[model samples]
Target: MTTATPHHLPGTDLALEQLPKVSLHDHLDGGLRPATIVELAADAGVELPTTDADELGAWFAEKSNSGSLVEYLKTFDITTAVMQTREGLERVAREFVEDLAADGVIWGEIRWAPEQHLARGLSLDETVEAVQEGLEQGVDAARNAGHRIRVGQLVSAMRHADRGLEIAELALRHRDAGVVGFDIAGAEAGFPPSRMRDAFELLAANFFPATIHAGEADGLDSIRGALTDGRALRLGHGVRLAEDIEVSTEGDGQVARLGRLAEWVKDRGIALETSPSSNLQTGAIAQWGTTLADHPLDLLYQLGFRVTVNTDNRLMSGTTLSRELALVADEFAYDLDDLLVFQLNAAEAAFLPVEDREALADAIIEGFEKAR
Candidate 1:
């Protein structure tokens, strides 16, 4: 029905968008379509730098590529401004799932802070319900369009805000209603998860899963706090965990020695929700280098850390899960099996029940096999 050439995997004819994928770290507000933003801006009484869809999209990409996490985050102000109303949140959420489905993402976790969407006097409870309704609509829309996709919300609490526990309880309240996990996002350097010990403790007691954003803007200490205090089952952009790994020239070949923290993380199989493009844009991987080839993703994967690729912010990074995988494969020379492993790692790391995770993995394997 369409003549657009499919994006094939490098060195193979396999269509990249046809490959099954699991996205564990996509943000809701960060993935809004530029055209949708333009439409919503008018209704929300929000002005934009440019109303042209393509230019607005380019604006986000260029502004976010500033190589500073703080600077990169400034772009969110434009996105979240239009997402204050129920209609805006619902439309964004619905489109988010549809877009992921189009990108061959079989499953995804959409993270966004409810506290940030209250500017229009909508209650937190109302916002969560609105999002859930939209997500359900998205799943149906994707199904109708002949794409199979499942999505869940990972309600994020702004780390800089003092509403951690309140946000945690909000997630817990909606745990049975489409919400899958909890997370702490925004300005990760000064705001360690330890500061939200009460929130972590509450979620832990309730047997809820948390994936904290750590090791991105900070160092190993931040990751340590995530594990010890935040009890994070997964690290959001845990790229800095590579800092603890000491790699050296051992004559003919390289050797890597893991620090105690690194050892703990790898041994425990704590998932690293690493986003390559977002990491570079936010300077999360600056310590290693500026280029994608300099990313320690390969090193971490070689060391057997549970590494999972993600599109942290689709609009800002101008990426999808499929695009992220292609970038990684281009940099690392990964084959089909390697890409499958990344998807499986994310499947295991997903905050779903054992049976559900297993089912998800089975679906992924089947999809890859079909590709073969």
Candidate 2:
């Protein structure tokens, strides 16, 4: 699944796709290849907007750019519909890892809601097992292909659903097997992380880590809830956290003031999994501006906030981690050093143990140095 050519920093030969990267937030159902979807749709008896793979990919991109999270999410119904069976899940999950390897991801956490795939008679546990089986196969395939790619499942509970605690327990059950963490996704405006207080409490009691979706479709309050209620170790698209930072011009340069909430996130080093393209498509960065130059990723990075680049939905956004970094780099005029910092930030924010996180960071540095 590797691309014929790698994505590079604009006006530079530095191959962004060849650099080791750590993806902290990526959705499984949202990353399917369009051709695979057309094939699976027939087997799963699902209808599609088009049987043509190229057109199907274009349809997803257009639907996702609606500037509304709810509207953008409608595209997932088609992807999730085709992923109901064991074979469908396995193929999607396997291709997911291979795609990450193709984009030079050293490690990634693929998040998906298991409850969404149960319409075809698959139980919660059964869905997790099926995906994990596929992940193992994907990892093995990547290794055989000479890509040092590793991945873990961050089982997500749909925020609009009432099965948070149930899904949390499911993640814990597979903690040692293949699952690495827990997440709550889907609609974000009304359903704050506080709605899943019991699930967070359960995870906290067992000392398991969580990364909650916040500051994307919602605002400061949602980010607050993610920290206080969800006990999130990382934030899924916490771009709107920038709303709390006030920048004012001083004698010469501008000085930024961080509100209490912003300070806590920065001081504690809670990672913001900011996906530039997806942020724009979801209107997550609308308050700032309509283009990449307006993205708070650069602001967050300059302010020393622990920010990690991601492709929230590869197929929907028509991107890879490499393309994300390259796009942002082009907008912000970032250099290789800046790129390495993002990768190191993500490695530290990964759900792996402290020692393993250190090892991952080392690998990223080693890879970047070689590429240089």
Score candidate 1 by lDDT. 0.93
What lDDT score is found at residue 354 in candidate 2? Answer: 96
Query: What TM-score does candidate 2 get on C-alpha atoms?
Result: 0.99
Lowest summed lDDT window (length 10), candidate 2: 1-10
The ten-residue window of minimal lDDT in model 1 covers 1-10
Q: Please provide, for model 2 over 1-372, each residue's C-alpha lDDT reduced to its tens digit, 9 standing for 90 to 100.
A: 646467898888888888999999899999999999999999878899899999999999999999999999999999999999898999999999999998899899999999999998999999999999998899999999989888999999999998999999999999999999999999999998888899999999999999999999999999999999999999999999999999999999999999999999999999999999999999999999999999999999999999999999999999899999989988899889999999999999999999999999999999999987
TM-score to true structure, per model? 0.98, 0.99
- Write the residue-wise lDDT of candidate 1 on 23-67 in tens digits: 999999999999999999988788899999989999999999999
* Candidate 2 Cα misplacement greater than 4 A, ranges: 2-4
RMSD of 2: 0.8
